[model samples]
Target chain A: MKIPLPARFRTPVLLMAGLTLLVALATAIGSEQLNFTLTEMLIRMIVVIGLYMFVGNSGIMSFGHIGFMGIGAYVTAWATLAPEWKQVMLQGLPAFLQEHTYPFPVAVLASGLVAAGVALILGAAIMRLNGLAASIATFAFLAIVYSVYSNWESVTGGTSSVIGIPTVVGPWTAVAFACLAVVAAYAFQVSRYGLMLRASRDDEVAAQSSSVDIVRVRLVAFVCSAFLVGMGGALYAHFLGVLTTDAFYLALSFVTLSMLVVGGIGSLTGAVAGTLAVTLIVEILRACERGFALGGAQISLPRGSQEIGLGLALALVLIFRPAGISRSREL
Target chain B: MVDPLLRVPQPTAAELAAEGVSVRFQGLAALSEVNLTLLRGEIVGLIGPNGAGKTTLINCLTGFQRPTTGRVALAREDTAGWNPARFRKAGVARTFQAGRLFRDMTVAENVEVTGVGLGLDRKSAHSVAMEVLDWLGIADKAARTAGTLDYTDERRVGIARALVLPPAFILMDEPAAGMSDSEGEDLVGLVTSIPTKFGCGVLIIEHNMRVIMNVSHRLYVLDGGRTVAQGTPAEVQANPAVISAYLGADV
Candidate 1:
């Protein structure tokens, strides 16, 4: 008799297929309300999977991923914005940057490339450090990037933000990219480099003795993760028709990390679940804020309550599940 | 019979050598001015007491720790300047005490990573990994995660991982630490056979006396951060220093 596929492979295949079909159907038949929500959640899903590439494989917690997203968003915004509109928003720009207007796909590609390039430079330095030191170094990197984005008046439009980004990322595009991210993340997880990265994470001494180039493996994941996260950022920039350094700040970093932590740290399905669950929770909180008006007293909740909720959820998940919702298993 | 007076000329190179290597942690000398040499195709055992510098020597050799003084050379090429991965790529591989297999990875996957690290393509690495697993008699467990294995099996898997890279030198830290008598014997047999089978020098740090006596062609006894004795197993076991170190004042 032929042996059946193991539960591990079977479960993920079935779950991924179901999710793909659900996303397709929702994008096709659902109202614009549902479509927009699914699209946004799918985009976040891509970002989370990108996070999983580095965080999951290397078993390192990073606070610098948002730095990559900022790089992508600004690159995409600069590429896709109309020349005259860019002049109005950006004012004094370099001659070469001002003259060129890239197509949407080309802009997204550029965003990923720029992010990977930055990751390559940064990862070479950051991956050398170990454990909490590496964590602190990456956090410092994020802070530095955020500060640069907030202060760089000409290139990044300063803290005022850059608007008039092209609307190229829609519901279908988001779903398609999310699927691609899932496949890419899963492929990396199963590849030789992925095994080496995970081995290094599990046992540094053994990995070293085995001659595994831990730093190089981590750089691979770091650059790949940055590329995907940059793509997600480009999609977000187009979806919103605006881009800001603040859009890719620590708050968004924490949100994305919370999704990964609350879902599961090392599993692809956990990334998607965490993103979808967190996004829905934020949407619901927003709806409650708008809908609730008690007895004309106007008892209004403060903004960004979703962040507080997410933080609490992350803490509770860490305390209770410890391995996040999926444990070490995939969705 | 070999002529007792005939002197063999010294080889042009020592396969692996440590000169005046010392590792001090907070003024405590874990290893002190240790000098060792292993010729090609030799199996050497490092035997010591609990606090003896056996593991520290291995760590220094593998580039996990920098020696406070002196130099380590592999094939007469200075390795003191090399990092762990550089050491590994330059034909050094190691196995840890308690078998530090990647818990989340399958046994075959663990070996495959080692093969890949040695510059094998994926298809070839997969086959090589399976071959190693089969050689170690853990082929059936190839699909099983390293964490799911028993202590003996995990030890075997660790050896398989080390051997997959086919390094010129393999350092094993306490390979027989937690094994039963028969398992330890099997490990001793496996390690002893590696030099002939794979043509790789083996340096084993083991606390198990039976394993040391069985597998080691030459043995180094260390105590209090110094070499107490070095000789063939029969010669070393009969040495006053080795006896005193092991038996204490009772001897």
Candidate 2:
């Protein structure tokens, strides 16, 4: 159906509508357990699409974005947790946060801003490096964030699940934010900044010769993508009402990046498709691992099938369709 | 009615000059005390052999290289250490010998990006790109991916993109490297019209002596990175030093 929007916005708005409808379908037909699964899917979609906004446009594989997600998740935890709980369990938070709990929207915005702020500071230095050096530097950055958060016992509760946060994120919230991420990313993809960025990606020399500031443009994309992923991380904090540093570590980074790659790392459509495709496969495998009842028998894959299956899937995609299923094509 | 794309920045008595510029590599002088200048509304040809430092000179003029000694001046203002992007923003644009088109973008996008980089809004950039493409007579190929263009078309798009920068001084590095005689004739016409049509100075490096002689109002001949001759096209063509230094080896 034709959406009465500007020509520049029509496709993204339509894509958002389609995703919302799919989530609505899932909500209507499924039980509460299914709602949780759908929420997970939507949240991952937001994070992966955020990755694409930077990686796809700049052709830079960032290993540090999930660090921004962790910051967002932790910020939301600090902001939304009851003041009484913070006094007893944590005292490192500033007085304002320690004294008052904020609404969901306020915490989400704070999460995104704080994450983006950190990205701006770090990306200034990181974006100066290129190719393999940039990749390794980002990886090193991710490790540093993980270590700091894991050991900061006073503020972070360190290496353990920080609980007592309000559980406000549901399937609907997840769906709404996923749609927002999709639209925002699309708007950015066609913006002049995005155009200059993709130009640099194709040929750094050509883009510079055209008067593009390559480092500055990459940093802009970095900060913008961090904002989206940070909010996605905040949703995750409320989804389960617990924050664990492990959940925001290397495993999360690789899984989200794999979704981007397997779906087509070059296009936003690939980000969405990769996340959905990989999430469904893992969920199905998890169900089998739990032993599904078959004809007069219980049949199941062995334990730890999900991780193994993900590896094989990524390997197969790289071997046959290295560009991913969408092949970087936009909607 | 004049097209908006044609209404570029005023000529402003602009002059892009390399004064006593010298570049040395590991104690070897690549360019020794070379000086050249391009003024608004004039076309000058720079002719040299393979290692005559023509591309290196273009790099110095356009901010890709720093001369070991001496400074480049734009409009009589010294450009001490400007980078390539800064030089481009100051209305000096150049194209590579290799035709470095952004392979992933469409032909129109290749030009539009330069316009946008030059601070035009997206809508204006697109219109300017369309106008430039139309003027180049390749408007039909606007939607084709740059990587998919044939060799000749890549060169055309390269020139089109440089023009979209609205440059006050343009340095082309072997723009007519590979083309038929008829195609070369068309290029000669295009080079000739650039100064009058866009109010920009042109410094073209082409090995085709016939084409360069036909298009240039004046010529600067470089052999072994030093000026062999500099004068009106006729004056330079008849100089024994230029014929012996350049045409002797080339033809």
lDDT of 2 at A325: 95
For residue B120, model 2's alpha carbon misses the true position, in angstroms, by: 1.3
* C-alpha DockQ of every model: 0.60, 0.81
> Candidate 1, residue A319: CA error in Å?
2.2
Tens-digit lDDT track of model 2 for A65-166:
899899999999999999888887678889999999999999999999999999999999989998678888888988999999999988998997899888
Q: Where is model 1 chain A poorest over a 10-residue stretch in terms of lDDT?
A: A1-10
Task: For candidate 1, give the lDDT of residue A16.
Answer: 65
- Clash pairs, candidate 2, are none
The CAPRI-style docking tier of model 2 reads high
Model 1 reaches what TM-score against the true structure?
A: 0.91
Query: What TM-score goes with each of the models?
Result: 0.91, 0.95
Tell me, by lDDT, which candidate is best. 2
Interface C-alpha RMSD per candidate, 1 decimal: 1.2, 0.7
